[model samples]
Target: MFKNKKFECYLLKNRIPGVVLAVLMTVFMLMMAGRFELFNRLDSKTYRTLNEIESISNPYGSDVKITVDRADYLGYDYFVDSERQGSYYICQQDGRYAILLLKSNDDVVLNYTIKGRMISGGSEYSSIIDGITSDMGIAVAQLETRMYPLIISEVDFPRIYYNMMLLVLIVTVLWSVYVIVRCIYEVSCPWKVRSVRDVLGKRADRQTIRDIDSQLRYEMYYDQYGIAITDKYFVCHGMWHTDVVALDNIETFKKLRTSSNIGSGKKKIYKLLMVDVDGVTYEQDFRSEKDINEALSYLSDDKRVKR
Candidate 1:
């Protein structure tokens, strides 16, 4: 597929834009990686603290303060001691104190106050850890609870950074796949142009460009294609099909200059025969000026041409 000259030309024409986009995407992915690494470390630190608390017999009395690392406030296992002491909830006063209400086995509510504040996870606010500490004199046997401070950070789960990187990756993969598929399709597409009578037949309209006006439409190109001019219309033969432009529809005709620098540093100019149909422009370039004039002469009577 890569050996095909037309596909090679297509790649050459689009290489600059493709490279520029790839570079931009790489930079953005790098930035996202940095953010994930930083926040991931922060979250891991808090999780390690929780692991440490599990080994301690009296975690609630410890001076070590830790914060919630995840976006949700209920980061630590809320039901860690649920089987022993039932369920617990925070009191809703000024929201400064962690007034935990424990529902006892006897259906009695036991209130325990702890010191803490609310923490935010970027957007939503959570009271996950902040600065919670249980009442100092509470017997461990009576409560069977760990009262260590859960100090958590407000920043959690870098969604914007990760989501943008994911989107870019998906787009890049899809675009690369599309380019490959399109190249394959184009390489396989067949093109042919017989005589006007053979292709268009005698019943088709064969008016010259000068006979039509702004309502006429056509398509033409120079790369990897050939031009055939009949008395009725000029046909641009491509891999798929041909576009016929009547001479009567040609509102304007001129030379369109184009250049390419595929080999070495030498600039090569192309002589493009530009024609207008309706408000749209169609153009085809030849290797030399003589060829362009000859192609135009086949479509129009006054073949002096314009530059």
Candidate 2:
């Protein structure tokens, strides 16, 4: 029933559109919070130890190739040369090097990163210079009006969970409630049948009882309201009824006194019966016990059946 409950909540979670949405919001969240950014950040944090540094020349290019003491450089090497190189250029900062040459193999090879320990020391360190590639005659400009640094901030919310979507969900819930209540009301009124046989038999067991169950529906309905019965089974809604038992049908009479019993144990073949003023043998296989009893009591002679 609440199949979409978890989904709906998840959509609005994390103050979306920060958590806004993707094809699979759950997948995106589990991925990195903001899509693949989560995994990307984690992988970025994982790096090979800096170890000792070394200098080497590619000899093929005018650039001087700087190597690291370790083997697992994560497939990256640095360059240190002021002259324009054959392919790429690299420079040093905070003990790490940055790459220039927008199309340089060095840029692709060297996995430059922002190290926290590098910046925390003091303002003697520069933010942009601390970034990779900024030292190679390259620079990044920032908005000056912002007094404090915006980096390392977790912000942005509400944009993801929109109001229109919420309104639609509310309307859907209301529709469901209305559907459920209407079904309940339909259930409150137990349906009934008018079996010429159940009330009486070929002999009508008692003709008086037969007349009661045989009463016109409206006449029977008014009297049956507010009645509580536990023993009888209600078949289908009265809008549809079954074939009625004939007034003098012998087989029908035999069916009436079955093993099935209410006030007492008796043999019976259970079937819902219905009555229609416009049809003969109004008794049908789909009547509610309410109607059957109403019809029976309608014809009560002992005055035992009451409105």
Candidate 3:
């Protein structure tokens, strides 16, 4: 089976896309699995103190509790939208200064536990704090040196991130399974001579089978799809079906050119359109104009193929 050029070509053409997709999905699955394991191992329940924020390693995903006994609102609030907002504050806990971001809501409290993930502050937040400190006539250097200022949100960011990754991983697994199954079906169960003859309503005879087997040896064009021209028949090997038409039954054959915009330029697509005497049309795509032209040249000698 591997030595036959037609079967080998068909196998590779149908299997390569699925194999590539499965490999990519497998890589993504491994990466997501590692991330999920990391998140599962993190300490999400125990709340760390503000003083330990800088000292603790991998504080980005760890839960932290900020006791806001003395908070100076900087009069600046960050708004993602109308529904979501965070107010910045400069808090003092046991002479240690740290930045706190409280989710905007009714019934403000001066003393409460602000619990959430300890996320590093971005440069934009630093710039905003710089302006706030300047307006209040306070030096930024006055803040504690042991613990740098960081943002603390009320939202459970770690849980949300883990859920999003899980959703993507599930989708990738499903797609990988579908591609693998399709590739297996295409390669394992190809269209045999009997199958092609049945599709074309040919009689069950040794001569008919022999003719198809002989024609398959010399494919005019073979890729994901194929077309074979013999002395008396035109055999088309489609992705999911095989069709054989007698040369006398073919009424018309024409080349079609279409152009479509791709980015900043146009890409041309070439196809061969075949119409039988019964007005049944079959269209096959060609990778290039030269390939379509070559296929057309093979049928130019036949009087039945009207071009």
What are the per-residue Cα lDDT tens digits for candidate 3 across 1-307? 5444454354546567667868798787868678667444333444445666667676675666556665666666666767546676666666666666776443345776776666777874677667866876877665325335566655544656666767777778877887777666644444433444454554534455445555567633332337677666666665544556666566788889998898889989998887778887767778798888877877674654554
lDDT of 2 by residue, 186-284 (tens): 222112212323433343333332332343221233323222111121111222221223322211111121245656765344332223233323223
Tell me each candidate's TM-score. 0.35, 0.21, 0.48
Which runs of model 2 end up more than 4 angstroms from their true locations? Answer: 1-129, 132-147, 151-158, 169-272, 277-294, 299-307
Best-performing candidate as measured by TM-score: 3
Error of 2 at 234 (Å): 15
Error of 3 at 141 (Å): 22
Candidates 1 and 3: which is better by lDDT?
3
Per-candidate Cα RMSD to the true structure, in Å, reads: 13.8, 20.5, 9.0
lDDT of each: 0.41, 0.29, 0.63
Top lDDT prediction, candidate number? 3
Query: How do all the candidates rank in terms of TM-score, highest first?
Result: 3, 1, 2
lDDT of 1: 0.41
For model 3, give the RMSD to the true fold.
Answer: 9.0
